[model samples]
Target: HVHGHFFALLSGYIDKFQLSEEWHRFTGDSSITDVRKCYGEPRAALHEVCKYACKFSDLDDPKLWEFHQGVNGGRMFDPAGNLRGVLTGELDQDSLEGLSGPYRDWVATWLWLEKKYHLQAGPPPTMLPYV
Candidate 1:
């Protein structure tokens, strides 16, 4: 069974992976193509097929506008400076490369939806000095 700590860790991941609001706005009008120009490439840009079962739960009671609220108790925000997305399930060394096509697009789409709805509400991370 998943532990409560797992959810907390997941939320932290999401936060770190999220793009700063400034970057979001700059690319807001830009098409996906434009985004590629500004942000280079995305890691695990596409969603991999669920070869095995994955888990999702409603942790924060997310609302339509309040995207962050629904964190689902994943606490996906990363504590590290760099960001990444976690792809769980029964993925292994070989299977990861094959799970392409719409699967990848799925992850990208979800990221877009999250940023569009619940952006950081400030300038880009580049501009923000470390605390």
Candidate 2:
């Protein structure tokens, strides 16, 4: 699922703008409950994606922190995509561990690009990637 989502984002078949729109259309607000209401119960991995989106949107609020804490600190995601253990992939790992690994690194890289390009990967619509 993570592979498919990553490739969907990477291949230009579905851009962040489209995702942002879909997020807005589904969520109707920034609340995860709303996300659940519209998209059903999202996995822990999906929550990380939302956190990244919130960061991109400059959503420096307590709810975001709470959400982070709630979803992280568990090995739900697969760290190596190996099938040996529970392979939840990039979406289910704890926050600190993930920060030390590839997901957070990728987020940092995207943050750099966003800063350089003055773009955002989340809500408010206008700041999202155009292409």
Candidate 3:
């Protein structure tokens, strides 16, 4: 069911953002959990996404307030759309690997535009949450 969780995670984001990607339009016996197997991500690496969250936002601190706060959408989220904490596509370890030098440079340029424009992704955490 790990694959299902991952698909839930991805679809959670995709739907949350109204990403408008055709990849999500497929119809079949497919399950959201099968995304990794279908798209090819080592099953072991799936935990990477929430590793930091678990470490900092542990039982004592179930929510990583500071980390989410740093993610600003400038009051951009609304209850009607069901949007919440922002997602950083960059936190992926593979982000810069195998990319052209110029394109990589461009990505770096906008890495923190959220903080700069006062567009908090969700909320900022003053201290790392307990894992």
- Tell me, by TM-score, which candidate is best: 2
Runs of candidate 2 with Cα error greater than 4 angstroms are 1-3, 6-60, 79-82, 85-131
- TM-scores of the candidates are 0.15, 0.24, 0.17
The true-versus-predicted C-alpha distance at residue 88 of model 3, in Å, is: 26
Tens-place lDDT per residue, model 1, 1-131, is 11111111011122232333433443443222112221223222212222111223222335433655555577664533222454556543444221222111112123333432121222222222222
lDDT value for candidate 1?
0.28
In candidate 1 the C-alpha lDDT for residue 25 amounts to: 45
- Arrange candidates by TM-score, highest first: which order? 2, 3, 1
Greater-lDDT candidate between 1 and 2: 2
**Candidate 3 residue lDDT tens string, 1-131:** 11112212122223332222322332223333223333456333434433432344342322446646655455533433223454556543555322222111101112232321111222332332222
Q: How would you encode candidate 2's per-residue C-alpha lDDT over 40-86 as one tens digit per residue?
A: 44333444454453453453556656766887886655533334465
Best by the lDDT measure: 2
Error of 3 at 123 (Å): 35
User: Runs in model 1 with CA error above 4 Å?
Assistant: 1-62, 76-92, 95-108, 111-131
* Poorest stretch of ten by lDDT in candidate 2: 97-106
Q: Which regions in candidate 3 have their CA more than 4 angstroms from the true location?
A: 1-20, 23-43, 52-55, 58-79, 82-131
